[model samples]
Target: MEYRKLTESEIVELQNQGCVASNWDSISVHRQFNTAYIRHVNFSGDIKLGIYEKEFTLPGGIKKHSGIKNVTLHNCEIGNNTFISDVNNYIANYKIGDNVFIHNLELMYVDHESSFGNGIEVTVLNETGGREVIIHDKLSASFAYIMSFYRHRPALIHKMQEIVKLYTQQNTSNIGTVGNNVKIINTGTIKNVRIRDYATIESTCHLENGTINSNEYDPVHIGYNVMAKDFIISSGSHVEDGTMLTRCFIGQACQLGHTYSASDSLFFSNCQGENGEACAIFAGPYTVTHHKSTLLISGMYSFMNAGSGSNQSNHMYKLGPIHQGVMERGGKTASDSYILWPAKIGAFSLVMGRHYRNSDTSKMPFSYLIEHDDETVLVPGVNLRSVGTIRDAQKFPKRDKRKDPHKMDQINFNLLSPYTVQKMFQGIEVLNELLSTCGEASVHYTYRGCRIKGSSLRSGLKYYDIAITKFLGNSIISRLSNCPCTSDEEIREYLKPDSSAGLDKWRDLAGLLAPSTEIDKLIEDIESGRLTCIEDINAVFEKLHKDYYSLEWTWAWDKIQEYFNLSPDTITAKDIITIVEKWKEAVVKLDWMIYEDARKEFSLPTHTSFGMDGNKKDQKIDFEQVRGIFEKNAFVEAVLEHIKVKSKLGEDTIERLSKCL
Candidate 1:
């Protein structure tokens, strides 16, 4: 693609075709540039034009030749086979890439040097601005998690900030770029933005200082009435339908539409926001809300769902929105629920009704926080038997929409990880202490301003023991999967841990469930300037994610020894058989519980409106047709099959151990 000064005769032909140039000598064109396609276009200020010979067949079978018509360009370069038409204002100070189709654009320009949304400090979590995450195009949920939550380590924070600053400085430029194969149609007022390859911007309004990180693998889409400022929307994400954003970072494969608005927020992979509002929040992977009046403000959430009319108060009316809350992964809120800020919710917990009390359930996972008589009542370890919880865990990995090869977020959808299991361990200890101190005969107990009934406390203890038995059983069984252990020594050798990495406490660092010891090592590297590059930091996270299973086995083995009162050196096949028997019982009991819970969906009370104009038999037929019988339900069958499989596994292991005896 060579550019040459236009000939005198070619200039005359362009002039005859309603085209004008401020300086004829300043304009340059490709050697194969045709004057026949240039019509009614105004050009100025050092322009370069490419060969336009391709035909674009648009929707509705409209064939359009790639050419420039009815447009005004200033200090711009047009790429090969690109089409530009019907610009109301101008396209200036930008380079339009190859094969782009631009029509009905009002304004597109670069006024000054910009980093295109990189290094934009998004005030997440706390609105008064104590916690701010520097957003860049390659920002991952784990990266933002450490920066927003680990502000106490000033040296680490300073090193991380400086690394991001250097990257942003390298990206600063005066000339904006519209990459190859982009389509910008009926758009208005794009300023100081970088449009990457294969992006589609249709009918969008007012984008400023942003990066649309579109690629061939996963292109981004910005549809009608979308207005954003100081943002970085990653690949495969769609932000459209009257959504408004300011100072936000939208990670890969997220959806924001239906008039949803957010300010100073960071939404990571697979998160959805529709018909709601968010302010100063950190929404990690799988945080979703699809109802109106659901306001998420000054909160940190991951793998969470907000019900309709769910709200949280960030201000006590005394301070200026300085409070924040954390709902650990897999948390949910019932419709019309409310919580005051500075509260911490446990993993896989449910909240129902309004609660004025700031009860922190951080150490009690899988609990129900209910408002009864204006007091919070905690029901612990109930979600383990819930069919809905199992379904949610199964659906997250299946529903992942990210198609990018280089994914920014590393998400783990495992429900029974060390992070939650550690919480359950603490829960059992806490419940036992309460029983010993409050006396078993007492009817109710209170902790952290939340009431716990005596029956609930007993049930929690039983449930935790069963679940821990199930987990440890599963771990030991998996460890000795194919080992031919004929004697006690062989059994002990087979059950040895692969690594010692997971002996420390585990933390759910956004989506990755990893040991705190590993995270501390990463922090040390950052603070000591060994991991200065952002890519290097991300690589460490990826390695940690890859080694999760090896690390998990070590953690599970330690817990097994502690909970089952056995050492690897002294443990025998007989002891393993005992654990397996407990494991089999726990697995069978939980499956039956979940199976009974699923049956509730098909109960008679649920069939009230099924047969409105019919009798009892007709009602039965309608219910069976609509909801299906509980026996044939997919989840119910899976649960029953799990019981069969686990029971057989236990019996087989016991028989092998009997042979050893």
Candidate 2:
């Protein structure tokens, strides 16, 4: 990319083409620069022009040579084969890369030294100022989670902030980069933004101070009427359709469109948000909200689906929208559902209707929070049998759209992991305490600002037992799958914990689910100044995520001894067979419940409103045509298949155990 002096003939040819410059001596051109086609272009300050010899094909099959027309460049370097034309204002203080296209843009400029959205503190979660995460190009959801929420560890927070500041300083430049093969067509204003290779930014309104982390493999798109400021949109993401964002970090393959307005939020991979307003929220992987009336504010969420008209109140009359809530992974809200802030809903739980009570159900995962006559009723562990829960778990891995090999976020998409299983273990103790304190015959028990009925308590205990057995059995079976033996010594060795770390509490730090001990180690490293780089922090999360299964087995081994009352050292084949049978029963019973729930969709009551113009028989016929019979439903059929597969798997494992015995 060496530049040579412009020839006298070339200068004369440029003068003939109406191209003017402040100082002709200060401008340099490529060796093969052709000034014949340049027209009405004004160049100022230091400028370098490359040869425009490449031809481009328009959408309508018209071929045109790459050349500038009716544009103004201010202290810019134009690369070879790049076309810059019809800029209404001026392209100032920028380095346009090779083969880049900038057409019909109102203004594109870099004003002084800029980080291009890096090191901009995003006031997430609390939204006041204590939890300000400095947004960087490599800032994943997990890292942001720690930086925003783990403020109690001030040293770790300071270290993380310093690391981000170092990254920002390293990335600071006066001249912004428009990477090779980029297209900025029909855009309005792009100020201090770094456009990456293969990015298609068409019809964008205004993009200021952001880094579009696009590459050739997975090109990012910022489409019509999109206004983003102080943002870092990662690769494979699409922020289009009039979406407005400020101080946000949008992760890989995420979609934010249809007039979605988000501020001070972190949306991670595969999240689809539309027609909603999100403020100071942490939206993790697969957290989706598609309704305009849905307002998710001052909350932490992951693998969640906010239903239509779902709203959460962050402020009581005393506080000024300062309080926040956490809906753990796989949680869902029914339409028009509401929750007061400072509440914590459990993982895989469902919230229905409006409740003013601030409930904490974090210890009771897979539960339901239903509002009955203005009272919040908790039905614990009922969602373990839900078809939707299983479907959501199965679909997440299949829906991953990130094609980049270097995935920044290490997402563990397991539905039942050490995280939830630990909660279940705690839930069993809590339930037993409740039953002990308030006798078994008590009609209802009150705990954590929610009422649990007698029937619900009994059912919850049963559901938790089934889930715990299933998890422990699944872990043990997986461990012994490849190493089958008849001896109790071999079984004990196989069931022994791989690592002592997983025995402690587990946490879902956004997308990275790991034992709290591992998180503590990361914090300790940061505090000791051993982990300073963002890459180093991300590497730790990746390591923990990769070793999830091994850690999970460790946790399961401890639970098997505690809950099943069987010492691993002397456990026989009969015990393994019994566990496998329990697992099979839990698996099939849950699937059958889901199957029966699916049948409710095609019941007579469901057909009452259908075929309103005809009789009840016509209603049934109409329902059959439109909704189809429940037996023929796709999800129902899948549920049946799941039941059969799990049942056969359990029988096969038990049969193998019987042979060993």
Candidate 3:
């Protein structure tokens, strides 16, 4: 594209068409520029324009030529076939892309050199500044996970920071970009922001120092009075309806709307926020808050849901909002629930009522933390039988909205992986120690700022045993599902783990669950100058995710040997058969427990409100119409079917092993 001054006849044609310029020599155009398309435009200071020969169709089917009209541009290069109209202030220092439509915007410019939103230090998790994550355009949830939690490994942190700093330096620029096929309509001041291809901005109030990493495959939408500063919104996300954010990072496929206000926070893939407020929090994958009164402050959460009016206190009046808390994945809070800071809640646990005491229940997964008469009561292993927990596990994978091939977060949606099972094992040991020391006749036992009743403690032990049995059995069965083994030696060979990488402690890094030992090895490589880039770190995470099941068997094999007190060298066909029998019993028994739990919803007491104005027969009819009979319920039928399928699977495996004897 070449630009040149207009001829004498072309200058008269431009003057007749209401085009004015400070100096005609300063205003240049394409060699084939059409004078017919130039109308009602004011240009100043080194402006260059591309040839526009096409027409743009408006949303309501009105068509207009693709040219600059009713606009004033300064120090800009307009692309071919772009339409810019009604810019009240001006668009300066911008390189507008081809096929773009910019209309009714107040001002769009770049003030000086900027990195968009990269390298902005967001003080997350701990507001006082011990945990600060520098956000970048390519910042994945797993990368941020290691930076925020791996504070003990200072070398690893410094290495990651250096890699990110290199990325920021490469992206620093003077002129902003509005990529091809972008639409900006009814927008207000956009300053030092970088817009990517195929992104849509409609009715936005203001955006400053941000990067919208949108593309044709996964376009981002910013709409309707939304205001953001120093933020990075990733692909396939929607931030709309008066939502205000400052110093935040919104990851892929996320949704934030309904005037939700957040500051110094990081929200990862598939998270949702509406009508709530967040400050200095790390919201990992699938975190959702839908109510206006919910305030999540200074906490780490993943696979979490906050009910209406759910709140947390991060300051104790002595410290200046320095207190922090951790709620492990799959945690939920009831309406109006509150938790004081410095508390650690376990995975898949539910919190109900207000708990002022700083309780730590990380060793007791699948439990309930309830408030009874101003005291925090812990009921361990109750959520294992909850229908809601099962539903959550089933729906998480289905709700994933990321359509891009390169997903930002590697989420693991397993309900009974080694991450939670390890906690359950510790919980069983703790409960047994309490029962032995306090005597079985004691009414209540206290541990870690909460009280557990004798009956509840006994039941918790039973639940933990059932879950552990199910997990180990699932692992072994899956490993040998299609093995061609007819002898005891062949069966033992099939049970041998493929690798030893997962034989130790495991961790859930936001959503990607893997062995902690492997993560440490990767960190060591980084500090040793072996793995030096962000891509290298993410590739290691991808590899760990790819080999999850192979590694899972190694850990499960070791646990099986320890739990049953039998080694592979001496174990026979009879021992394998016995484990299969135990597994069948555990699976069927747990399914029966869940079935009975669901039946409580249809109990006789639950029909009290349904029969307020009816006789006995009418009451039965009304209840059947609304709630339906428990035997015919969908969830009940699924539970019964699951029991049958699992029982048959276990029995068939045992029968096959009998031949080896």
The lDDT-based order of candidates, best leading, equals: 1, 3, 2
Better of 2 and 3 by lDDT: 3
Considering TM-score, which of the candidate structures 2 and 3 is the better prediction for this target? Answer: 2
Best by lDDT: 1
Residues forming the 10-long window of minimal summed lDDT in candidate 2: 482-491
| Model 3 ranges off by over 4 Å | 1-12, 22-32, 45-48, 53-55, 604-623, 626-629
Worst 10 residues of 1 by lDDT: 652-661
Q: Mind giving the per-residue lDDT tens digits that candidate 1 earns over 1-661?
A: 6899999999999999999999988899999889888899999998999999999999999998999999999999999999999999999989889999999999999998999999899999998897899999889999999999998998889999999999999989998999999999999999999999999999999999999999999999999999999999999999989999999999999999999999999999999999999999999999999998899999999999999999999988996798999999999999999999889998999999988888888878988999999999999888888998989999999999999999898888988889989999999989999999999999999988689999999998888888889888888888887877788888788778777888869998889889999999999999999998889999989999999988999999999889889987798888888999999999999889999999999888998998889999999999899888889999899889989999999898788776667
Point out the higher-scoring one by TM-score: 1 or 2: 1
- Encode model 2's per-residue lDDT on 1-661: one tens digit a residue: 7788878887888888898989888888887777865788998989998888898787999876787888999899988888888999999999888888888999999999999999998888887767888999998888989998888888888888888999999999999998998989999999999989889999999999999999988899999999999999999999999999999999999999999999999899889999999999989888999999999999999999999999998888774878989999999999999999989999999999997888999999999999998999999999998878888999999999998888988899888888898899888889999999999999999999999999999999998988887788888888888656666677677777777877678889887888888889889999899888988889998899889888888888888877788886688889888888888887777778878877777777777778989987788889899998888888988888888888888887777667667
- Candidate 2: pairs in clash: none
lDDT of each: 0.92, 0.89, 0.91
Off by over 4 Å in 2: none
- When summed lDDT is taken over every stretch of 10 residues in candidate 3, the lowest stretch is 476-485
Cα distance off (Å), candidate 3, residue 25 = 5.0
Each prediction's Cα RMSD? 1.5, 1.6, 2.1
lDDT of 3 by residue, 95-161 (tens): 8889898889999998989999999999998888988999998888889999998999899899989
